[model samples]
Target: MRIVRSARAHIARYGEAPSFRELAAAVGLSSIATVSYHLRRLRELGVIVETRGRVSARCPHCGLTP
Candidate 1:
């Protein structure tokens, strides 16, 4: 999933999670709703998590927080 990969990379490079708009741009997505849809699915699958409006990979080995 590009969104997940991009989110992890963005956090690794910037030391913070990206906003939905930033993520949309990073993954070449034109709609924030699409990002939201994918995020929801990812969350349900335990591939990602959201805390206080920030999104991060669920795997601890990813070494990121949001």
Candidate 2:
């Protein structure tokens, strides 16, 4: 919950979604495994969604340009 919320907050401020690496770095989490677990949670919760690959792209279904 904390990771997802932190990530969402970061995105809300940055205007673009952060990659798992960026989000993890911002929140001080030390492992990609941990971030991956949390990211799955966020995806399942519908608070975030993954899409076609890019370093900092928002979902086509949601975001400023969508």
Candidate 3:
């Protein structure tokens, strides 16, 4: 998924996660809700971590606890 890939790249480069709005723009998405959907999917797939609306990328092998 581009959303997960883009978020991972942003985290790797900046050492901080991007906001939902920033993520939407980076991936050419127009709606924050769409980004939120992708984020939920990513969490299910163990590719990222989202807690209380804050987000961060996670490695597949070193999966995030929450």
- Candidate with best TM-score: 1
Question: Once model 3 is optimally superposed onto the true structure by TM-score, how far is the C-alpha of residue 40 displaced, in angstroms?
Answer: 0.8
TM-score of candidate 3 to 2 decimals: 0.78
TM-score of each: 0.84, 0.61, 0.78
lDDT of 3 by residue, 1-66 (tens): 677677777877877788898899999989989898888887888788786566787767755222
lDDT of 1 by residue, 1-66 (tens): 899899888888988888888899999999999999999998998889887677776656666565
**Count of clashing residue pairs in every prediction:** 0, 0, 0
Question: Which residue pairs overlap in candidate 1's backbone?
Answer: none
What is candidate 2's lDDT per residue for 36-56, written digit by digit as tens? Answer: 886777567665566653123
Between candidates 2 and 3, which one is better according to TM-score?
A: 3
Who is ahead in lDDT, 2 or 3?
3
Instruction: Assess each prediction's global lDDT (C-alpha) against the native.
Output: 0.84, 0.62, 0.77
Model 2 spans > 4 angstroms off: 53-66
The candidate scoring highest on lDDT is 1
Off by over 4 Å in 3: 61-66
